[model samples]
Target chain A: MKKVAIGIDIGGTNSAIGIVDEVGTVLTRGNIPTDRHSDINLYIDDLAAEIERIIASTDVELDIQGIGLGAPNGNYYNGTIEFAPNLRWKGVVELTKLLSERFNYPVIKLTNDANAAALGESIYGCAKGLKNYIMITLGTGLGSGVVINGDLVYGHDGFAGELGHVCVENGGRECGCGRLGCLETYCSATGLVRTAYELLGKSNKPSVLREVVNTEKLTSKLIYKYAIEGDALANECFRFTAEKLGKALADFTTFSSPEAFILFGGLANAGDLLIKPTKEYMEANMLEIFKNKVAIKPSELPGADAAVLGASSLVWKELSK
Target chain B: MKKVAIGIDIGGTNSAIGIVDEVGTVLTRGNIPTDRHSDINLYIDDLAAEIERIIASTDVELDIQGIGLGAPNGNYYNGTIEFAPNLRWKGVVELTKLLSERFNYPVIKLTNDANAAALGESIYGCAKGLKNYIMITLGTGLGSGVVINGDLVYGHDGFAGELGHVCVENGGRECGCGRLGCLETYCSATGLVRTAYELLGKSNKPSVLREVVNTEKLTSKLIYKYAIEGDALANECFRFTAEKLGKALADFTTFSSPEAFILFGGLANAGDLLIKPTKEYMEANMLEIFKNKVAIKPSELPGADAAVLGASSLVWKELSK
Candidate 1:
């Protein structure tokens, strides 16, 4: 019988559930609309049923491991989701407990999506055999997971590794979190678009980005598209974003001298366009001892199913411990 | 038999050696001048002799545990002192290997002084039972040891937790490490004196610090003396230093979210004078979740013997592991 763990990736609009094997293969998967369920218990019941249905769809006889969850503001210690603004359910929700009651699993683990991504990288991706590394996910907003000596840093409050909020340029940019000059304000996917607009406003360079700068369709994906087509302004946006990110990583080295920093999510898909410049700027700003050491690379997880793979890998990691 | 460990605190001018019991009592201790030894081997021999003399002087039949040494640039993984600028030795010193050859010990451990201090706090000082905290030592230069989940963060190369080198400003103050805007340049003991001079030169204020600012007589100690006596310029210096430290601590929160930040060394002796304002500024600058949660407290280790106790506690910490 194939041993499998149920992975749940909870998002603001939709939640993906999957049955994953030990080797990181998703046997079966489905999604549930989260925004429609305002009631926490109703959402939990729907999520649990979707997970069971997905497991039953698998042809192989499965020996069920446990369930692992990844969501915004997920707390590992208490197994609660506290005040996550993106989720429709308000206040604290005992997510792991509610879901566990429906299944006969031995353990249920939950952490923020970024930390799950880090665990996934450690177990089945580029960070394999590397005990110290940081996983950076650059989606709409930036998220991070700091791994040291092969364990995720949960910190005292189970809320460590919020590297996105680290101030990069004090009082420089306003963040949604009501902070000024957060790293995420300049380095996330949206941050790339913001950079595009800033560069578009500054220079009179005739470029492809000028056609889309005032449009609602200006996205990091579009910027990536133009940059690949050799558009000057679009290419400059990536350079500007990478420089800020690289400088921040250099400062982060002083806290934990990780072996590498793995980039994931939308902006990371730009590949060498992002990683190359980030590596150079990081080396330039790093202290002499850390220079030419830490590697900056893109995440190796399969793009479309990365979140599900990360969520399920959490079970394997906990079982190993 | 009573269990004891040898602790060696190697400094630029002098080295202190002590035989400490499992309960953190220093049974007997001695010192050797580190600057007098031009050769690394000669220094190791003298350090070994001092340890033996201290152990022999103890009255009880002691079961020697192991030896732990704390020095500038000490590497725990390699057990060597690598390019310590203040020491008379020019290159890497194999102090642990040579000392281990003379002593028939079960284990020998070495780490930078700040890390050792953190271990001492965890085992025998105020940080007892606290799994997550950071120890900041504000001596001639700023040094820090970050403890997370009950272990010192010894990243990939065992040179992690160099928080003093974290850049607080982009291109502000020049540091001895040839870097600009390092936290140490504005927050250490010398940093405090520098702040005093900066304030003194900025305005022609009628104050006690004005009398000594022109002379090479200004010190953090003198500043503290006058601040307690209600001198405006002297008080401003402490407040200024605390604000920088507090803001830096706020940024550090995003990385580790430690329970408390324990302050040590000369400037930290100001007690509430430094701790109060630092706590306030840290709270003001902190993220909502971390605000009012992390404490800024003075070190609880007895001042004169802190370095030696910290070194000896390393053996106890290792033995428990």
Candidate 2:
């Protein structure tokens, strides 16, 4: 029988699972909608039932090695999810303990979704063979996983890599975390819309963005399309975003001298529109020692399966150890 | 026969060597005036001769396990000193190689004095058993060594913990590194004097510090004395230093969430006068998760001997490994 480990990526709207082999090949997988139920136990039971149903019908004779879970507010050290704002659950939820009780496995593990994505990148994606790098996930909110000396920096309480919450503009935008001027507020998909609105107020540029702005239908994808079609205002919006991102990257490099910063998620697809300006400004603002080094590249993992691969990589990593 | 290691702390003005045991007991030690000879070879020869002379008549039948060297630009990776600005040496000088050739036994390692001090603190001083923390040495310049996951964070290159060079105030103070507003320029002994001078221009408060308007005559120790004696201007100068230092510390905590920040060097001796206000500001500025949890305390190492114990700890650590 082929040895396999289950990887679960828990999102706000959906959950993904995969049985993966040692070389990052997903042998089998399935997905389930994240129920709106507020009770923590019911959600875990549903997830457990779904996982069992998926693997039971698979043709491949498999030995379930372990389970790795990636979610918001997941603590790698404590094996619990504590006060995840998006998940209406209050206080500490021992997801790992609940899962292990259902699956009789000795190797259950967990990490924040961002860290899992970084592990996936490190093990199977763009950052292969690179020991020092950061993985930035540009989704609804900006998330980062810091890798230094080939290990996740868990700090004293496993809450170290809160890169999104770090202040970029000193006293600029208000964040959901209640902190003002957080980097996430100026660099996420939401931040892009905020930037487009700010630019719309300042500029008299003739563009399709004006129509989108009037309807309040401004999305990062629409902005990318306009910029690619030679809209000056749209192009300027990306430049503005990159400028903040580049300066933040330059500041981050001072702390951990990584060889590269691998970007993942929706906003990362803007590609050269965002990357070129980020690279230019990163170089411009970096200290002398870090000059001409540190590559800013995109994730190599398939976008659709990145979270699953990342979640799987966590179990793969643990089993290997 | 007892096992021992010779720890060398090489400074610009003087060099100190001590024979230290595993438990941090300094059996015997000696200091020699550092010769600023143009020829680098003569400097090495003199250092080795001094070490040999110190151990010549000792009654303890000892096996010199290894030699650990702590210098200005010491690279732990290559065991070389590379263009330390304070030192006249131009190119990469493999001091460990030179020492090993003379001693016939393996001279284990080298690291910058600050890193060595951090290692020393972790192994024998206040930071013993604490995996995550940062040690700040405030002398002629501010220096830092970061510890994450129970080891020194060397980064991609050996030059990771250059916290002094990290820009705190954009276009604020002129740094010796030719960078604008580096943390060191506002937090070191020199920074304290600069703070006092700046205060002298702004405040007309009656204080003894006004007697030294020239930067040459002003020192951190003198300002510390005045602050202790209730000079409002001097107390304000310390508060200014603490605020900058505190903000920087809060920013750094985002990267590596250490349990505490251990402070060392001349100005740290001011105790509560400096630490209290720094602690207050650092807690005030820190993220909600980190507030009031992190301790900012003075280093427990014995004065100048910290570098020696720290250097020795390197060899001892390697041998234990």
Please tell me which predicted candidate would have the highest DockQ against the true structure: 1
Residue A271: error of model 1 in Å? 1.5
**Ten residues in sequence with the least summed lDDT for candidate 2 chain B:** B208-217
| Per-model TM-score on C-alpha atoms | 0.97, 0.94
Best by lDDT: 1
Per residue, candidate 2 scores C-alpha lDDT tens digits across A105-206 of 758888889999999998889888888999988888898899997887878988788788776655678888776677788888988888988988898878
Report the CA-based lDDT of candidate 1 relative to the real structure: 0.89
Q: Isolated chain A: TM-score per model?
A: 0.98, 0.97
Error of 1 at A293 (Å): 2.0
lDDT of 2 by residue, B81-108 (tens): 8877767667788888888788865556
Candidate 1 lDDT, tens digit per residue, B255-311? Answer: 988999999999888888898999988988887778888988789888888899999
What tens-digit string does per-residue lDDT give for candidate 1 at A36-122?
Answer: 779998888787778778777878999989988999999999999888989998899999889878887976999999999999888
Clashing pairs in 1: none
Alpha-carbon error at B267 in model 2, in Å?
2.5
